[model samples]
Target: MEALQSVYIPGSRFLPTKRNMRMKAIDSEVQHSIRRIVNNRIKAMKAEEGNYDDLLGVMLESNIKESRAREEILNVLGDQNVDTDGLNQLKVVNMIFYEVLRLYPPFVGIARKADKDITFEGFSLPSGTQIALPIILLHYDEQLWGSDANKFKPERFSEGISKATKNQVIYFPFGWGPRICIGQNFALLEAKIALTMILQKFSFELSQSYVHAPHIVLSLQPQYGARLILHKLQ
Candidate 1:
């Protein structure tokens, strides 16, 4: 853990080759942890009965119209007071994911180098200059997200991404423009599916043992761990 923490220090690369070796070890552990979580979710899904009426079912059935799918889902869940349809519920899930990303982006910062001289606003940058684009800084800016920028509020995204921020550039959790993450949609869908399945079977809340500290290595994660008290639903 100490070695992993050291890797986050600025200019840590200037250290000895032994330090680089430690980084590889920490990275491997991180990768293994992620794979374990994904594999467990996949195994659980596969073990489920073929008859599913939730989000996964909709996905598996394929080619259903958005509104029709929502209707089917609402029927399966027996939820009448929701007022909103399945599509809107999906939107709410997406917004929740967006809020999570805003608080803790996977790539906290991305670097870009200037190929030639350029001017933006009133500032000038010469060729061969490197720029650090700290996306998390923009994600939490008061001007873009209002007074509650630091707090978790998925409702802020109810209107959609374009209208959520003061400027479009302030909300790039997966990078922006042509250089954006190619697997962004896939990643989000994977998360959405897993979250849906979990929510379907269980209700959960933070346990007394839960810690709120978020630490960043390659990605943001709970420093102590996310301890939750879960209750299985009928």
Candidate 2:
């Protein structure tokens, strides 16, 4: 139900409404089945013999580093009792992801159907009409992002998401509003943890053969696959 509702399918919205009790029941069953499968896979992982260094392990390691950093900060201040929950020393990692999202959002555009007639910016939109929101264009607009809009500037997000641009609405890589993607937080946290682990383990740069063109087929992707030269850290 979650995946179907989010993905652009033929009749997703029309399928499992309050009026369609039968379909709703089926949807619930499908969701349960997916959860059961995921739990089983986790159990299988726990049952395995060999050691594995995965995202969860990496996050656990990061948690230890965070504790140490917190203690160091407390020692410097001579106040060990101060709360450290609000501190975020890993904010730079977040900025890197923000810049990546600005340059190449997962979805090039999102479609919305208008149920009623509306007028905006001197343009009229009739009822029962569909519109494609050009997200990347808005993301890269110089008016909002300043003269260096074309450049990859992760430092822009150092002050936080709200201050990243003059108009905060312009940065909606996960879409916006009540109908925004349900898994937005999950996706962001996953990316942050993965990027943090990668940076900790290796140094990497774009390969000489790398291509920069981006295209979309359902979701935005590189026209040619990204090539990187990774050097492992000891």
Candidate 3:
């Protein structure tokens, strides 16, 4: 949501396109984010198992492992690897996930079909008309997020979803409704595992050349590549 806004909303100084372009921009971000999240999980799994097939291990083994599977779930443990801690330990990691969402929301807009004609903002929109919800605009709505909406802040979500969204239907990075992402659970779990491992292992800083420029093709990608420096941990 915030990420999509980074492209169109005024303060961000990004240009806007029609609704379809916005939707594509968001989907591209989502697909790229998912791949990186999965790969990171793979790396983390290897740290324990030496080899990891991830979900396959859970799906095929859960029936055999039963309730023990949750105990063995590393991603849920937050900062602690599954072997060292349990879901009770994952507060910080969850917070990080929320921040990632703020910085790189996966979708720009959501399209819906109107069941009946409706008057909106004073205009009569006919029935069967499609309504586009510009997630980018709602997310950066300062009235809802405060002036710091553009700034990266994980503490905003620390109070949880209601506080983060101001109890509105605005902050939908994975979308909403019955057709919402089925793999949301899998993707989130994977992201936590990967992000945790990366944080645990390194410290990073953006290079002098790094710039906050994004482009819209299918996804709002960094127009300039993400050039940064990572220092390995001892």
Model 3 Cα lDDT, one tens digit per residue, 161-194: 7878868887877778987889888887776566
RMSD of 2: 22.6
Highest lDDT model number: 1
Residue lDDT tens for model 2, 1-234? 655577566765577566467767888999999788656545554454312256443333334333333343434333322223422455655676688899899986788988899998998999988999899998889988997687655668878888887556898889898889899878877765555445545556566686768888788888898887778756
The 0-to-1 C-alpha lDDT of every candidate, in the order given, reads 0.69, 0.67, 0.62
Alpha carbon lDDT at 69, candidate 2: 36
CA displacement after TM-score superposition, residue 119 of candidate 1 (Å): 2.6
Q: Arrange candidates by TM-score, highest first: which order?
A: 1, 2, 3
In candidate 2, stretches whose alpha carbon ends up further than 4 angstroms from where it belongs are 1-88
* lDDT rank order: 1, 2, 3
Q: Where does model 1 exceed 4 Å of error? A: 1-89
Predicted structure with the largest TM-score when compared to the true one: 1
lDDT of 1 by residue, 104-219 (tens): 89888899998999998898999988999999999899977898788666668878888887447798889987799999988987776665555555556567687669888788
